[model samples]
Target: MSGATGAAPSDNPQDGERGELSIPSRRPRRLRTTPAMRNFTAETDLNPRSFVLPMFVADGIAEPKPISSLPGVVQHTTDSLLRAVEEALAAGVGSIDLFGVPQEQTKDALGSAGIDPHGVLNRALADVRQRFGDDIVLMADTCLDEFTDHGHCGVLGQDRYGNQIVDNDATLTQYADMAVAQARAGAHVVSPSGMMDGQVRVIREALDAAGYADVSIMAYSAKYASAFYGPFREAVGSSLVGDRKTYQQDPRNRRESLLETELDVAEGADFVMVKPAMPYLDVLREVAAASPVPVAAYQVSGEYAMISAAAANGWIDGDAAILESLTSIRRAGADIVLTYWATHAAKLLRQGR
Candidate 1:
């Protein structure tokens, strides 16, 4: 018989000798034994305000066009874009990052449409600002790839060897102009994702000179040239022949991200972002730790498409995966997460699933 009158005898001789084989004093599973306990003990939490939805608005489209690579995402027409923004706002999404897909005929060597006040992107920005009236943050993509025929982020030039190269200085000029235009169109923030040198400083000066000193700059400081951007090319209808290895950071370098982050901060960036969040969470965590300004992580289109595709095939739980992915990003020290799943994830968070 055991010490307690009602207890049964030990099964093992060792248990009888050692007073029922001394139990562990520490049991980590105690905290995880119940849902409420797990929730209460969670180290990181997700909130709708921490999410930013990336939306693509296409010119010359009467209806929204589905992006084949990105299952639930679409290139929105002006009307549909506004409706989507409304839905996102209703879901408590904090911001919308707008990318413009101009008509193919409008693309040019200099990507002039990017800086045009009457461009599709500027028009959409104006419409959204007028409708929402600062109820939501309006962020515009300050890159030229969507408006350039070559689908490069900057203007192309020939070197002495006749090799085509992206002119970094020339692209800075265009980025400055586009920043002013976006600010004029009522963009609350302009995100420069081109990864050009001196871009943030030039845009800041231009914005101040153009009397848009109030507009914020979100720098893609640690953006890497990654395979994760494959689906985004389809979403934006890119016509690229080569890569952006010269401008975008190399994926192998960890120290380079800190250099980029420091440069952006020194150059007047209000926020800094790391691209392809999951793959670069290590970089993101380091950047977030070092950056004085807020840090954002982009859960790029490829990340979205992979989980979405797997979920559609019944290989994984879509809802749980989305939450877990976003939570991981948050845990990695991102203050804001830019994702296509923002609205859906926000709804799930509200439902406490």
Candidate 2:
């Protein structure tokens, strides 16, 4: 048989009729053909300055203690914390958020250590300020959960029916006091993560009254009561028994987040944020769209642990996943991202650029 006689017809009927090949006129692939082209055409660009590193400083620790669930993360001693801050500064991270881990024996019902001048968080703030002197934006987690033995984020009381409940007004008083304490300790920002109603207004008033008008309040405006916070409990050494569904936003509701965001913005939150960023990207997008203030998203402990664990198992490209996750949050409208991988991600972004 002759080869030409057995040849197949053109896949396109028109091509066979005209004896011509079909080609696409518009080629989006041209833009993606080269790495340089992809970088130039990139819609969302990440910068190290947009990352905020969340750190833990433990009181009365002779050495840094590793949190098993958090893998590379640890509860730093005062000495180690200063070193870590140096690394973060060198990495060009935008900020560092400090969480105090009081010794178990020191925890109490009222979480008084949070307001004490010599409190672990306050002392860590002072030390970081004395060393860095505003080289970085220092933020304090102004919540009572880590310091309170009961592990609720606020003061507790009994309802008329004899059920224990977090007293909203009383907790606001404690939060106001805590904000002032954090301000005095050299925090540039006091972040109220307790998800209390009217917390932003109360904290703002207290900070201004204490001559800390310059201190900014970053409200945990749309924090959801998520199980994604599992590793955070370990990171902060929390004593929580029950869930915080009573105070934190319900994961199923989006409208409530917008309302909370609006209230926080009206009350003087310099920044408002959505917690457990990956799980609440939709909420973050809506909040970012409606709020006039800057919006932040937190890649919480569980999110980090999942990625880290998978990476360890050789199931995913760790660096790529980290960047992708961060980019997703940024694309969803977060001006800042509070993440455990902040320093590492900062370095990754620099290397990539």
Candidate 3:
């Protein structure tokens, strides 16, 4: 029966002599086949209006001082700050985040200058508001790190062991006062970047009681104690003697971001932000999904400087990298992006290049 053979094999016509057909059915590149198609089908869009530029204003400077670590960024005098704002407006960027560089003499235990009506930040806010005339969204950085002598985000006190610890509750009072001062100075939004517990709620109450119910609060919901912030310390002349590990989140933790975001949302934050965006895209996505308000991501100084440094060395194409990084942040669910490249990016976006 085996020798009889059950059947005869026949050559298939489709295979021909090569035993293969050259039809390509799985063409993923069809979606990207043309520039028009690519542009039309882009999942995320980056625009100048969605960007907020962070600016530094020093108290007594007659001229803008360049920050060496953050190339193209500067600590501006009040006049220079106004000029920068004008440039930002012309570029179609409608928002600016202001950080004040106070004189070293004014720093103290309670950061009392933070609440002073005549303080650096307060004065700068007034100047910007008056100069811009409500055309721009003026945001004030509501944190004590720049104002405190000890350079902790909160008030410092001695523990039982006599080691210095941040006095969180006491600091909340100072934050509330600062919030009021910023609002009085005409800030459209007061951003609490201190990562202190109950800060949003405290600031909200203070603003409302002071008849500043219109002012918004942006909370730094998940700020990690990352080494990436080194350039930022230099930009603001931060006097921090020790790491913020005791207060800021550990870089190793992922779930903590959600917890912090949830707390900020419940505490009356008008918006929640993920700082140092490049390193925490997962956290940004999770927080964005859970937030009822808008989500913002800060492409910090280190992120900008690194890219610029690499671009300068010809290691990467700066233009492509900048757009790609910003697009990634937007795709990850950030409605707003704060970056040192805001003005340049805005100009590029406007030119349709």
Candidate 4:
């Protein structure tokens, strides 16, 4: 008898009487034989409910302004922002993380507009709540940089030596006030992205004191001072002249992320996040492992711009790249992902792509 490949039968009886080869015991490829099989065996699935869209709402704009560096993203006017939120809801995005870009005139050293009940951010929160009515989660960015003239995340002060620096304790006070304002304005979650120490605790206490104990806090626990935030600065019209290394985590450190996660969790963060997700998946994994609460990762502006630029130049499949990048972040154990592609990715997931 011949084998299935039509090989001639072995002449010697000792050479496997039927001229058959031994079958391998292990065949991992069997599970990957088809799309259905692959889908069934996927360890990490990207769910639409796990996506959070980061939106920029320019306070005084009459129309949406495109961000040049971050292609396909824009600084939205209030009306435009509401439309975008509606679109996101239709596309099944789980939440919208709002960042307000007040006009330059509204900025001040203290970023007092951030705590004003009628500030752009707070009004946007009110508008979304009125429109959506709990149909989708509304998250507010509780930070001072977007509202401050100096573009630092906190108030500035001088040490006894007269060296200027961000005042962490002062920043915490601002964050607490901002949290209360956001909660009052109907934010389901207030994400403190200033990277200030003890911020989560202060915000938590403030929310509790204000009878908003239900409002969640998502701490930017391991936000690295990365170059990836360049486009974000532009998108928010930041006037920052110097780096945030004094506060934001150093990109070179690994174990430090775990420590930050531990601190945020201890400080009563409902969720902890890692910024610039792609560049810091290792940190995300470590933080996710150590965090008792949900872990989120922000796919920052640079990551989006890089992928968008490459796709425009015909260097990569844009859709595939976006999906792959998000999948990688999810695989790294991010419970939620804040990405510009949240709406598009959610639609694709609905289509089972």
User: For each predicted model, how many residue pairs clash, with residues at least 3 apart or on different chains?
Assistant: 0, 0, 0, 0
lDDT of 3 at 170: 90
List pairs with backbone clashes in candidate 1.
none
Q: What is the TM-score of each candidate against the true structure?
A: 0.94, 0.94, 0.93, 0.93
Instruction: Summarize candidate 4's per-residue lDDT along 154-204 as a digit string, tens digits.
Output: 999998899999999988899899999999999999999999889999999
lDDT of each: 0.94, 0.93, 0.90, 0.92
Q: How accurate is candidate 1 locally (lDDT)?
A: 0.94
| TM-score comparison, 1 vs 4, better candidate | 1
Better of 3 and 4 by lDDT: 4
Query: Please, what are the lDDT tens digits per residue for candidate 3 over residues 127-217?
Result: 9999887899999999999988888899988778999799788989999999999999999999999888899999999999999999999
Name every residue pair that clashes in candidate 2. Answer: none
- Local error of candidate 4 at 115, Å? 1.1
Clashing pairs in 3: none
RMSD of 4: 3.8
lDDT of 2 at 305: 97
